[model samples]
Target: MSEPAVTQHPYYHPQPGTAWEHVDTAGSLLAGPTPLVTLANWQEEPHHVWSFQHMRELMPSQVIDGTDEPRPLPEAPSDLSALEVPVAWAPTVEELLDRTQTDAFLVLHRGAIIDERYVGRMGRRRRHLVMSVTKSIVACVAASLAGDRLLDPDAPVEAYVPELARCGYAGARVRTVLDMRSGVTFRETYLDPDSEVRVMERSMGWAPRNHGDPLGMYPYILTTTAGRPHDGVFDYRSIETDALGWIVERAAGRRMSELISERVWKPIGAFHDAEITADPLGVAIHDGGLSATLRDLGRFGLMLHDHGDVAGRQVLPHWWISDAAAPPVDVREAFAASVNEPVLPGGWYRNQFWFVPGDNGPILLCLGIHGQMVFVEWSTGLVGVKLSTWPLPQDGDKLVATINAFRAIGRTLAREGG
Candidate 1:
């Protein structure tokens, strides 16, 4: 397992019968400056635990500025430590953090923060990479643009990015890519280093350097091949978000950082500036390269909770939020026939958010690799964001456990006066 096993990565596999309570990462760290943590090995366990928070040191990033006059968090702080969460081993709330490799966790009720904690090396002010959670934010912006008639989802990708006419995205619609229903033959298996997705990662500077095939973000998208028909199957391809990012740039005539800062962070009153990694050609890696403070993420969640209103201002369109949260019947049905995962049981993936319907209502979630997540229960106005650095890309049991923990948190907050 030390030599990059095909199915297993190094460090922190939970020992048998203990869940993740007994997992240790002391043996896997390359801590000193002698062994620098480059982008190539940055996603590994111990390295990722640090690199995820500090991507600016390895790659060029653009700032998503926030307002100087920050919107104060509603005064409703509670002891997250006492809020015990259920787990297979014990009822300790810490178990959820330890098992999931959580660096920061925040829970909000009715737009007021109920509980917040920073674990491991996480500090109050430091920004942590939200990974694919960035996709949801990007989706919100894209939907907002479509609402304003600045962009058309039904239009072909080539309409905005005419350069894609010869690429696999020639026939793909903006909405299809947003919903991840594009019939582009791009595999996203993170476990295999040689996979097509990894190739994309290498091009984006997330993986090891290969001087031979150093494709930029645009060129990589152009290399994609046509696959099955666009059948609304809810296929998840990270590159689709990048394509959407480009489409948005073309439609809005502005960079992603500028749009997000102007639209989201400033209006939401984020205290700290967010950042997103960019390729060498200055293309923002919108798929999974956003980093932001935990409080700002909660603020963004509050905006969604209130149907896109932030600090008395409508930062996003209400119709867009509701519609994206509630995907069409055909799209929802497609999810039933698509890939099955523990956390995504019969849920719809529309415009970068996952719709997991419950009896009370639907719980929209945005999950990223290595356990970054934003879980929102719109019915109860409960939102939870967890940033972590789990060693592996996917873990079925961990995914189940994460959703269960979110449910437990929601239920607990509902009964008490949080």
Candidate 2:
């Protein structure tokens, strides 16, 4: 099928504004020509990246899923000097630390906290935007409903969201949407004025500079026209996650934010409350817009590494974990081919999480735009969280190298402890 047509817009450049109110060193640290960050076929936008630590107030979100009781955290390691992994590609972490702007980093192994670090105005108390990592969290909520028979992956999506009957989602099955195989006619160009993604931004109030008529995201999503036949091929569409979120709301009879808090956050004993940004209409941006402290994100990764068991109680169904970690049936190879970009090779997308199929055992990762990650290697019992506000977007190579180095370091630690 042909790709959607691109739209042209007047190129924009960032103008110095009132310095970010939250960051103390905003003027001294963030001052400069905001670099243009481009992704895939997307055009570059003149953007001044904001530090993760100061993103909480910029976007608003509701707490959807969490547990009431705080899950007990394993003791933190006293020293992390023994863990070392040489970087095979890109600069080493130490070198990157010197050159790359970073916010927070945390590592866990065997359910124990091993290493934690913060940099450049980042602290344990601050919340950072997780961007697309929100997709994985939303996927978990959908999986929970499916586990309870509230949702059927094989069924048509219109069963839950009939409003999408006319858009690109028409005739698509829930599984296809979950796998991102929908035949939706949408463009993801970030800088294009006419792209549907840009339209989504305008609708969601993210494109503040655009004076065009308001095009709310949910309404635009419902209007997406079907392009290719359903299940014809795998296409990475963020709108699919949004659609899933809508379905989740329909089946659970609650908002995505609240559902996440009840089912995953509170039960797993999240260290802090996480928030998801909503549209002008108060609909949560499930594909992105999630924010939380680094420790809380690390704890969630630990829960996945433990096979959905927290404190010896099954918070999420074990089968749900297994299913979520497994690769998609039709799109594994296509997804894997993009791993060299920085994250993984031969990786699979399942339930919105990235799965690496290898002899080393499957590694499940939650990824976000602008370099947010929660990597969980089940075989080695390692979990790593990285949050960053890189000057530009679309640097998968750096992310991949960092994760590989992390895996290497994790192995060394396991051997020493063994």
Candidate 3:
């Protein structure tokens, strides 16, 4: 049976006397006074509000099918909107959501839904574009394959996909790619038109292709060159995840969509069949092309919070989660040397997940451009997912505020023992 139609939830109501307000997405969609969302403008504001939820209509996608009987999200709803979060910009959590262009937000504490809200056209069933959150999810699949002995992180990437030997990934190990430590020169500057990220997006069919651009992600991968030796300082490159995705597929003798469906989505009991945008050649855009519902993402976060345990079944490898949360000392040293250190003080990157030191414990983060995040508080057993359509790809203020909000919420729940 089809899911029920989505209606504007009461939780999205603007808090009277505050600047908070819902994003008006009712009219002027693809056709109207507003500019139409095309391959070129879909990532832009105004258009992204609608395009984020309707990506399948704009591009070719592969369905990561879910189970018919979804896992239940036990509801114990609370009014967290009024909760005071320590942030310089927003006075309350509700205002933070609005200020960040949040489409959907959900919080899970000990496997129970504590708060859930939708804004504009977003609802329980809508699958919003998750951008680079896809990287963390793809890493989960890679970890699972490793646990099954189907893939080896120590193995060179070219062992699985020999074609990569001629590219920048010539001598990079699968583990190197997972931690974004590959020596490949990939400028991830989102705003720069001539950045390597934009160029790769064009090859992947995400942007309008220009003359002389590579045909697809594969050809583009070959064009990249090694900037330095492998196993160097941490570099925030999206293409590393793409190479990691290819390695897992080759090791498992399957496609990324199938690997994700069998290894992560279904195992988590996702309610909706998630969609992944594909290139013109039908290659999955593993770096940042996933679209999934809010609740499903919360479920994925919960699994990580519970140390990869779903009830009695162990879905993700326990070792993988532990290593990611608390990596070796070198990982921290490497992260501290990177450009991200100033933004994330005393943090590290491992296995595609971002880790920030918290007062209680290490916090695990799966972040995407434009305010997409899955926040997991390890010690507090709090998991939260925020899906947003921020006008700009990166906003330091918004990102810090969101992280603080989740941290505050986790602390509150831990104190209450609820």
Highest lDDT: which candidate? 3
Query: 317-338 in candidate 3: lDDT tens per residue?
Result: 9999998887888899999999
Could you tell me the lDDT of residue 125 within candidate 2? 71
RMSD of each: 6.5, 7.4, 8.5
Error of 1 at 151 (Å): 1.0
Model 2, C-alpha of 327: deviation from truth (Å):
3.8
**Worst 10-residue lDDT window, candidate 3:** 3-12
Clashes of each: 0, 30, 0
Q: How accurate locally, in lDDT, is each candidate?
A: 0.79, 0.69, 0.88
What candidate 3 gets wrong by more than 4 Å, as runs, is: 1-33
Tens-digit lDDT string for candidate 1 (164-213): 88878888899888888888898888877667788887787665446555
lDDT of 2 by residue, 34-127 (tens): 2212221122222223434434445455664444556666766645533444554434555554344457888887877777888766788777
Superior candidate under TM-score, 1 versus 3:
3
